[model samples]
Target: MDFMIAAAIAALLNIGLLGTIIVIYVQNTRLVQSYFTYGLITVASAFMVQNIVIVIFWFNLYTAGPAIKTIVDAAAPYLFVINLAQTVGLAVMVWINT
Candidate 1:
């Protein structure tokens, strides 16, 4: 599939996950009141932000000059790995706190 197509799909999935988490936060304030819950929210937000960045990167790659696209391409993988680590850390926080 094309990069833009893939990025659009990722953005939709990220939005879905963010929406679900927000709903969870709203529905179970008791469970979502803890520091771990905050951490989860933060991580999820960061993950969504990172995906947004990736989508921007794809947009730039398609529309921008080569230099800017190169920079975005170089940075996107690092952001993805950082987001992945944050996700794992959030999972650990949930496991430890529960």
Candidate 2:
């Protein structure tokens, strides 16, 4: 049951992240064109951070039981939000610079 729940949460988070990137990409087309290099750099950095987080979440699930897994799962959302902010901040800086 916990495994199923964790997998579902992971999938949903991935989907949400993808959706967010797409929306940002579309809305910030000007920045993407004028400052695409910087924008790409920011997106790549953000993605690496997010990937590390997802990997850590998986490790926690493997090393800890579902009880702890539950806590990690709860924390994942908050972590995502922080990373999202980081990503947006970078993009915004590039936007402003352009």
| Predicted model with the maximum lDDT | 1
Per-model tally of clashing residue pairs: 0, 0
Every model's TM-score: 0.54, 0.35
Which pairs clash inside model 2? Answer: none
Residues 29-98, candidate 1: write the lDDT tens digits: 5755777767766776776677677667667675778768667666556555554555455455445544
Worst 10-residue lDDT window for candidate 2 reads 1-10
Once fitted onto the true fold, the runs of candidate 1 whose alpha carbons sit more than 4 angstroms away are 30-32, 65-98
Q: Residue 68 error for model 1, in Å?
A: 8.7
lDDT of 2 by residue, 1-98 (tens): 34434543554455455445645665676555657755754774566466556656666675688668667667656655655555556455445544
Q: How does model 2 fare in lDDT?
A: 0.57
Candidate 1 lands at a TM-score of: 0.54
Worst 10 residues of 1 by lDDT: 1-10
Off by over 4 Å in 2: 1-64
